[model samples]
Target: MNVLIVHAHHEPRSFNAAMKSLAADLLRGQGHEVVVSDLYAQGFNPVATANDFATRADAEYLVYALEQRHSHGQGTLAADIQVELDRIKWADLIIFNFPIYWFGMPAIMKGWIDRVFVSGYCYGGKRIYDRGGLKGKKAMLCISLGGQRHMFGPGAVHGELATLLQPIQRGMLAYVGLEVLPPFVAYHVPYISEAERRDYLEQYRQHLLGLHQLPALEFPSLDDFDDALRPRNAL
Candidate 1:
């Protein structure tokens, strides 16, 4: 399978960086075509602005999504965005490797999504959820956090990890039609011992090996909703 790993950590020596490297090496060793986009290393610009398009669809005003559709159609997207879009198009699976910040992804990572996942191509109108632009592709999150595992879940201080991640998994990945896989999270990375960190890597290796058999997270199918996008069975 073709895999693309979008790594967002700033520190090369960070645990998140190690995970990214391990994934690239291991996947390649398995004879899979792998591509790594180390955002920080590349000094990737995560900011979204009118500069993204070489030509404007409207000179007076900017509607970001509409502008994306126009630029994409005219083949005028910024070179950087086009590069990332090409990578996404080529991948059968995409792994987002990053460290959590404020119960969510880092700003750079979020900005990457904002700019890279174009409107007309990734999602538009009725082409969302199961019918989204990346329907056949798969996406998984490899996230690290300083919090302990016990801090999350039912009645825990941070609540459920699943709930915290719903925006990315359901709102973004699923919205774009990518099959969302359960995330692999490393807890208390900054505080963990070297042995524990090694264990996390080993466990991640096993997770990668079992990718073919890993079940995707449950998401609402377009078929379950009516024309207006309301649940078909809703009273």
Candidate 2:
């Protein structure tokens, strides 16, 4: 399996960067082809502009069925943006690694999605959940949280971790046609012991290696979630 790890954190010593590196070694050791997109290292622009598209016509939001085939077919994608499209094209599985900043992705990470997941790159002719550009691929989230897990608990401040990931889980991953899998989240970084951290890291690596044989995750269907659990609200 070709796994693309998109790391959004800026500090090399930060837990976010550490998680990305750990995942890379784990996947590569398993003999899976790995590609790491260190967005900060690459200085990716995390904003969407009007000039990305070659066409401005308003027929409809064309759903992308493949990386190369989107609203414009194969005319030409922006040179800068094309690089990421090429990366997506080469991966069977993608891991989005980042830290939760104000309950959301860093601006650059969101910007990468805005620019790279262009009309043809992500959308298709069908509606959300229908066949789309990322039809055959799988994606996972490797996120780190600064606050304690209690904040995201039932009686705490933030809410559950699952609810916090709705936007990325559904809006980004599933909306693009990739299977939304159970994300691997490491929370309460400030409190964990060295042994606990090592354990989590090891388990994380094991998880990615399993992707080679296991099917892409199908988010478990559940009942009645809060508004925070909706696609737009999940951080």
Candidate 3:
């Protein structure tokens, strides 16, 4: 399978980096074509602006989504965004490797999604969720957390892990039609021992190796909603 790992972390020696590296090596050893986007190392621009488009769709106002659709359709997208889009088009599986920051993804990773998953390319119109443009592709998040596992569970300080990731998994990945796999989260990496970190890496390797057999997270399909996007049974 063709795999793309979008790694977002500043420190090369960090546990997140280790997981990303381990994934690349292990996947390549298994004969899968792998590509890694080291966001911080590349100094990737996280902010989106009018600068993203060479030709303005609307010079008067900067409507980000409209501009994206226009530029994409005109083939005038910024070189950086075009390159990322090309990678997305080529991959069968895309993994987001990052450290969870403030209960969300790092800014760079979020910006990557904002720019690359534009209207004309990733999703628009009725093409969302299970019917989205990128349907048939797969996406998973491999994240590291400073908090312990217990802290993120029900009635704990952080609430449910699945709920915490719902915005990205359901709202973004699922919205774009990517089959969402259960995330591989390494909890309390900073407090863990070296052996535990190694064990986590090994576990990540097993996850990647078994990607094809893993069942996707359950999400509501378009068919489940009425014309107003409310659940059919609700009306």
Candidate 4:
């Protein structure tokens, strides 16, 4: 399986980067082709400039708060961009490894998602489940946090990690038709001792080696039991 590892952490020695390296090595060891997109190192154009679109040349997609996938079939990435898309096309699984800042992903990672996941590529919002583009692909996240595990639970300091990541799992990945897997998260990374860190590193290595063997992600629904069953007037 070909795997794409997009990492957003800036510091080379950061735990996030280390985890990225660990995942890459483990995947490669298993005889899978791996490509690491170190955004900072690559100096990727994070902004969605007008040039990205084949139709518009002077307007920015984000200005209109456009969230739909934009195709790069004719612009800067054009054919070159298709290469990365081809990688996604070729791969069985795609992994995003990064550190969450301000309760969200890094700008670069978000930008990559914005740029690469284009219309006719990632999703069209026509079919509800497993019917759009990227139907057979799989996606998972590997994230590190400075907060303690206890802090992420109910009535805790950090709230729930699942809650924080629900959109990515349900809305973003699954919304686009990719199977979303439960992520591998490492907590208290900033405070953990070196010995503990090394142990976690080893554990992470094992996870990467066995990631493909993990079970498939089941899609969820807006028919949440907690919310009222009646359809709302507003979309």
Residue-level error in angstroms, candidate 1, position 194: 0.5
Stretches off by above 4 angstroms in model 2 are 53-74, 190-193, 212-235
Write down the RMSD of candidate 3 (Cα, Å): 1.1
Candidates, ranked, lDDT: 1, 3, 2, 4
Residues 1-235, candidate 2, lDDT per residue (tens digit)?
A: 8889989987888777878988888778878899988999998877555455555443255322242343346555566688888889899989899988878888988888877776655765553343657877888888888887678867678887767778778778887788866678788875788887888787787776665565555542222234343544345
Q: What TM-score, over all chains together, does every model reach?
A: 0.98, 0.79, 0.97, 0.82
Q: Any runs in candidate 4 off by more than 4 Å, and if so which?
A: 57-83, 221-235
Off by over 4 Å in 3: none
Candidate 4: tens digits of C-alpha lDDT, residues 1-235 = 7788878888999888889988888778878899887878877766656555444433433431133243343343544345556777787788889887776788888877766776656665354346647777888999887787898878888788778887677767787778877688888888899998898898887776676688876774434322443344445
On lDDT, the leading prediction is 1
Worst 10 residues of 3 by lDDT: 226-235
Clash pairs (backbone) in predicted model 1: none
Per-residue lDDT value at 63 in model 4: 34
Q: Output the TM-score of candidate 1.
A: 0.98
Q: Would you list the rank order by TM-score, best first?
A: 1, 3, 4, 2
- CA lDDT, every model vs. true structure: 0.95, 0.73, 0.92, 0.72
Quality of model 3 by C-alpha lDDT: 0.92
Clashing residue pairs in candidate 4, if any?
A: none
Candidate 2 local Cα displacement, residue 155, angstroms: 3.6
Per-residue error at 181 for model 3, in Å? 0.9
Candidate 4 local distance difference test against the native: 0.72
lDDT of 1 by residue, 1-235 (tens): 9999999998899999999999999999999999999899889998999999999999689999999999999999999999999999999999999999998889888999999999999999999999999999999999999999999999999999999999999999999999998899999999999999999999999998898899999999999999999999987
